[model samples]
Target: MRLAWPLVTGTAAMTGSVSVLLAGMAGTAPLAIGLGVALLGCVALLAQPFLGLATLAVFAHLDAVEKTLFGFLPVSAFKLLSGLTVLAILLNGPRLRRNIHDALREPVIVAGVCLVAIGFVSAIFAEDKAMALSSLQKLLSLLLLPFLVVVLADTPRRVALLICVLVATSVASALILGADFALGVQLFAQSDAATTARTVEGVSRSSGGSDYNPTTAASLMLVGVVVALSHAMETRQRRVLLLMAVAIGTGALILSFARSAALSFSVVALLIGWRHRHARFAVPVAGLVLLMMIAALPLIPAEYWQRLSSFFGGAADHTLGRRMTYNIIGLDLFTRNPLLGLGPGNFVHHFTDPEYRHLPGRTMLGRELHNMYLSVLVQYGLIGGAAYFAMLIAAMRHLGAVIRHPASEAMRVQAVALRFGLFAYLLVSLFLPNEYTKYSWLLPGIAAALHRCNRLAWEGA
Candidate 1:
């Protein structure tokens, strides 16, 4: 009993640690905590039957705290995990930190840290105090995202597992979204109901704008497409099945009616075809294009069609008009506060009025910024934008290294395809805001892990 007691306690502690980490990375606390409890209960019931209750009680307490804190604080669980990781490093001598010496040595990390600092400092002079506070939260949220990526994505196995988890989440989210739309339930909140309704209607006709977010759904579908493509290249028997799944995901992306997603998918597909010269690849690609066109034919409203057509720079595309006007306002804001810009998240608050002088319907009252680059520029200033770009350049350089020296056939194909996928995402990001999404950090983190593993393979050779 005495020996089992220590074991039980240690197991409980470790389970909590694991739960905290998974919850931080995936943003799903209850599920992770449940798994942790199950693990603990299974262990305790076998050795110390009486300890099962105690373990359950501990799990319950943690779950309660998770529910309460995560509801109010988006980063509460993440901060807990960060604290735990730091504590572990302090105790265990920082072994993981030594694994990615190159990533650590890269100057981008320093620049990014400095840019984040400047963002906070600039917030003091922000035009609006409330806007500054919100911006501060956003800045901190985004800054922590990269750190989360670096800390959690330290190994190839972890990277693969992350992808698998995201795939599962995407699939589940799609199903939930479908059900919500069918049931006529509000499954998501959107900044613009009209945009959301149009996008959702394009994807699913019988049901629309359930609880699912179109942008998030679009991003997930993109991930599914990339993963399915990777799987098809590696697995012979499942190749067709994976390709079919990719088609489904692409179809879902179309249903999303996220113009940015459509643009991203098109650009990424072309890049992949050009990179590999796989003419057969065009078969699935062509199928998806046909599917989108077919879907768009009956479902897409005339206004949406007009909006898309007006993308070529015409008076009819009020969407472009809004974006162009936002850019002009963003530029004006940038010029005034060139050093720090309008706080970390205050650009919209400061520039929403007067900037839309021509359009009475145009208002930037919320966090919505159609363009990622302009949004970052207005919020973080040129200094922060430069730092962000530097980090991306470093990441791209690392990916380039992987393509030049792939460890295996699968690795080479995955690396090349992922590079194109990243490019696709960047292209999509041009039309929408995406620097703060979960996928944003996960992709780069996975890329970094792949890069590290390739180096290890080369060293072994």
Candidate 2:
């Protein structure tokens, strides 16, 4: 690993060692520790190509780190690293870097750009310009997400590094979350959810140790599972690493106890198993896959099965019923403002009004439409929805193409994971309005990067 990415691995090691030393330091030393680590990160940022991909591994922690940094720091350290990477590309401006150009040419990026443009235009008629722009800022920040991955993951080598970083982070997160729950401490420092809120009777039903919401933690853990599955099926080397990822991810996901996330995990597992069972493209990894799934099923707490059953009327509840109400309200909004809808960020503004709550079953309006797709349709209208779906469809199609191509078995296997990871997120998006989540935005980029790397390998580049 060190030989493959000397700069990134070395920088990561330095940070990890410094962090450990700082952890044991008695008092005021820890405050100064943050400054030292931030400086190390800055130095890493100067390494250009490796820096961009490495920053993504750290993205999960970057926001929290930004808040802890001293006021004298000029910018978001993560953003600064990303900006430096882009500047390095501009300076090098060479033929290989033109991979960025080709990456931009992917239909998914085109559709995403169209979607962003449509959202920006919709903001023009927004009820509140300031609020609309604020929402747009977040949306636009995410819209460039795939491009960020594309430029950094331009080569197969970098994509491998990206996967390594992602999987390693997931494993570390699991250890931290699990150990914290066992020790009854908020060991992650940044989660900061009060003792009562984070744990119930000393059992953590979330990644309470980390920055991710429990729901988001479930989704992240699902990502680890999917990637681990792909790697397990595709490669012979480091099978232990893959198994470790699967175990940790599953444990975290179970602790998260998110019904939709659990369902998504099961569906993705089944799909991968089925995909590999067919002889033409099918590999012989089905037995282990089935065993893994079967083992995972019993690990879930009994109450979670009850929670999943609620989705299908095992116990009719207000929250389940409210989703129906949300659908009705969303459709009504779409019908009235069909062309452009209520504009960006208008779902919450429009949905919370007393008048909207006058439905037969619903006495109170929902806080927001908890459905991301419906919310997008309500905000950006039909055109935006079309562009959004088009992007997703195109991305899915590209992955299929990559899988069918004659790349190395390893690339194809990982592509399988990338495809299913995106699918899992799509499944969970149905129940949560996580349209701007890093999970949703980052996936298309990773999938596209996988496809590009596989294609390059096939072409003998």
Tens-digit lDDT track of model 2 for 396-454? 87789888984776677667767777787788788777676666767777777778778
Model 2 segments more than 4 A misplaced: 1-40, 60-76, 94-97, 189-204, 208-210, 278-302, 312-317, 359-366
Q: What's model 1's TM-score?
A: 0.72
Please name the candidate that would achieve the greatest TM-score relative to the true structure: 2
lDDT per prediction?
Answer: 0.56, 0.68
With candidate 2 superimposed using the best TM-score fit, by how many Å does residue 302's alpha carbon deviate from the native?
4.5
TM of each candidate vs. truth: 0.72, 0.80
Could you report the Cα RMSD, in angstroms, for every candidate shown? 8.3, 6.3
**lDDT for each residue of candidate 1 in 218-239, tens digit (9 for 90 to 100):** 6545665766665565446467
What does the lDDT read for residue 257 in candidate 1?
53
lDDT of 2 at 230: 66
